[model samples]
Each structure stands twice: as C-alpha cells, then as structure tokens.
Target: MKKNVLRLFVVGLIWLASCSPLTRVLKNPDINEKYQFALEFYENEDYYRAGLVFEDLLPNMAGKAEAENVQFYYSYCQYYQNQFDLAAYYFKQFYDTYRRSDFAEEALYMHAYSNYKATPDYNLDQSNTTKAIETMQDFMNRFPKSSYFEKAGSIINELRGLLEKKAYSIAKQYHRLRRYQAAVIACDNFQKDFPDSELKEEVSFIKMEAQYEYAKASIYTMKIERYEETMEYYYYLVDRYPNSEYMKMAESYFKNTQRELYDLNP
Candidate 1:
C-alpha cells in the first residue's frame, strides 16, 4: 500500500507539471508566446493540448503568416487523434485555402488518405470508399510526379479489391437465399465489373448453378431456354478453368442440365 501510494503521488505530480505550462499559456496575453507554446506541444506529440492552443490562436493569427501553419497542424491534430472524417474535412479545407502554400500537396494527399482510413468494412456502405478513390485519383492527376503517386495507386487498388469482395459477397448471398434469378444477374454483373477478379472461377460456378436451379423451377416453356443459358455458362467456366476445384459440382450441374434439355426436346 505504501509503494502504490508513492507511485500515485509521483504520477500526479508529473501530470500537474505537464498541465501547468498549457494552463499558463492559455492565460497568457501575448499571442506569440501562446503560438510558440502550441508549436512546442505539437512537436512533443501532445496533440490534444496542442490542438486546444492552436484552436485558441487561429482567430487571432488570421492574416498573419502563422495562420497557414496553424491550419496545417490543426488538421494533423485531428488526424493523430483518429478523428478521420473531421481530419478529411480540415485537410481538404487547408489545401483549398492554401493552394500555393508549401504544404498544400501533402494536405491534399492527407485529405484523401483520411477518407480512406474512414472507409468501413467490405459489408458496409462504401460511399466514403468511392470518395477516397476519386480524391486520390484527383491528387494523382494534379501531381503526377509526386512522391505520393505510387502510394496513391496502391490505395486505389486496395479499395477496388474491397468493392469487388463486397460485390462477390452480395452475389453469393443472393444465391444462398435461393433467389436464383437475381443471383444469376448479380453474378453476371460482377463478372462484367471485375473481369480479372481472382473469384471469377467461383463466380462462374455460382452463376451456372444459379441458372440451373432457376431452370429447374421454371415452366416447361421456359426451362429449355434457361437450361441452355446454364450450359453456356458451364462451357465458359470449363474453357477458362478446366482444372477448377469447382469442376466436379459444375459437371454434375451440366450433366443434369443436359438431361433436362434432352427430356424437353424429346
């Protein structure tokens, strides 16, 4: 108990020592002094207090040369605090207001990167993901020789992969729910949208299976056409991936579909 009490006392004293400077600066009448202390806090990685000090200095520093630095560092404060949406907003604001400033290029990149960090998982809404891609693309177009160009390309590819995974999941979900017609349509759309996806084999199999199931449930007049569509998908799958892991199930569906077509034509 004595040791624990001593440790707590030491921690409390350190906390007070740290807080005193910020408290004194906030009360100081000299704006320059406060600005210097804010930069000190920011350099020391004390973003929360630095943000407070910077926020206080912004209105007074307007039209002064210090305003630009204050705005740039304030956006970084939000970013380091993981307030990504707010970071994106402030970073964009900084770049727009200081287009010719030395930090403008970095600020614009951070704006798009903040949106990328704000994007949700593959299953959630992806509006921000799309926005991040567009903003990053704009950055690349504006600064083709930037050091951030390669990194921006990588981010776009990763986000596109997320979108592809989401699309594939939705198509699979439709198939799982026995919405075979919708599943076939969704699978076709996914194929068209992501022609080079690694999931193409599985998607092709699912499309074929879904079409076969739909044909099985259709009326006599529609069964032949639907089954013929299934055969086309199966052939495409086999032609592209003859050694696919899904070939066994795909062949079973193909054989069953062919039997049906034969029965209908006979």
Candidate 2:
C-alpha cells in the first residue's frame, strides 16, 4: 500500500510539473527565456524537447552568432533521441541553409550517416541504402578535398557490396533451378555491371558451373561439341584461379571432355 501511494504521488508531481507555469515560462515568447530553457533541456539530455525548442528559434536566429551552434546542437538532439529520419532531414537542411558555416561538412556527412543508420536488413527494401550511397557519392563529388571523402568512399563501397550480394543471390537462385542459360547470362551481366565487386570469385565460379550444366544437358550426339565448349570455360577458370579448388574441378572436367572427344571421333 505504501509503494502504490508513493508511485501515485510521483506521477501526480510529474503531471503538475508538465502543466506548471514554469513550463510555460520556458517555452514562452521571450527569446532569451526560451533559449535558456532549451540549454537546460539539452544539458539534461531531454533531446526531444530541446530539439523542439531549438528548432523554434533556429529560423529566427539565422545570421545571429548563435545560429550555427543552435542548429548543430539541434541536429545532435534529434540524433541522440534516435529520431534518425528527423535528424537526417534537419542535418541536410542545415547543410543547405548555411553557407560557410563551420559545421557544414560534418552536417553533410551526418546526413548520409543518418540515412545509413536507418538502413534495414539486407532482406528488406534497400531504398534507404540506395539513398545513403547516392548522398555519400554526392558529398564526395562536392568535396573531393574534404577529409571525409575517403570515409564516404568506403561507405559507398560497402553499400555497393550489399547490392552485389543481392545480385549474386538471385543469380544463384536461377542456377539452383537449372536455369543454366539465365544464370550464365545473369552472372555475365553482373560482372559487366560490377566488375570491381568483391564477389568476383563467386561470379566466376557460378559462370563456369552454369556453362558446364548447359553442356551436360546436351544430347549424346551433340555432347562432344558442347563438352568442348564447356572445356573452354573450365580452361578460363584454370587460367584465372590456378590454386582454386574450382580450378582442380575444372581441370578434371577438361580432361574428361578431351577423352570423350577422342573416343567419339575414334
């Protein structure tokens, strides 16, 4: 009974504090009073309320000595509150609204990172991932000399790898279905589109397998010719990956194809 009474008392005090005249004074029309209250809220880590107060003063304080700091802190407030979408929006706004502001570059980078932070799992829609990659690319193009350029480039590479993985996964699905022609074409397209991707080994392996499958599905009368073509693919793999386990498999396949050709022509 005592604990219940204590809880009730605490809840009532919180309600009264929210509705108090002091709350009004802090959020009132006086700029200095509002600014001071915003500072207090920010210091107390009440970011949502602090962001609200700072946003209210931001436009009016533009060109004032405190504008940049206010906007910067306001953006951070949103970030700390886990309001990443709002943080991204405000950070981009700050980047666009301020020229020659000290935090401009950081704001731009954080705008991209904010979107990246909101990226979902790879199985989900990649809309935000694509947006983050584009934004980071834009940042790099705009500020080639900025110290953040390398970091941004690295992020782009990581995002691109995610896209590459998606493509590889879909292509492998086609392979598993015995859609050899489609799988071959998809892997070829992927290599053409993303030549610098880290999935090069996987793509090459898939391509060789797809070609071999196509060859294997041929009629016995045509098998010799088709196997010869498959041998060419295997040879390519051997040349590219001398030490790969796939290379050993390819060499075995090539020798089998050569002996079959000899037997068929004999």
Highest TM-score scorer: 1
Q: Please, what are the lDDT tens digits per residue for candidate 1 over residues 211-248?
A: 99999999989999999999999999999999999999
User: Candidate 2, after superposition: displacement of residue 262 in Å?
Assistant: 11
lDDT of 1 at 61: 88
Q: How well does candidate 1 match the true structure, expressed as C-alpha RMSD? A: 5.0
lDDT of 2 by residue, 1-266 (tens): 99999999999999999887446745588877788888888999988788888888887786678777788889999899888898899899889988588899999989998887887766667788899899888888878999998889988888877777777877898999999878988898888879887676667878877877776787788777776767776766677777776676666666777787787789
Q: List TM-scores for all candidates, in order.
A: 0.85, 0.71
Winning model by lDDT = 1
Off by over 4 Å in 1: 1-24, 219-221
Evaluate model 1: give its TM-score.
Answer: 0.85
For model 1, name the residue pairs that clash. none
Candidate 1 total steric clashes: 0
The CA lDDT of each predicted structure is 0.94, 0.82
Per-structure clash totals for the candidates = 0, 0
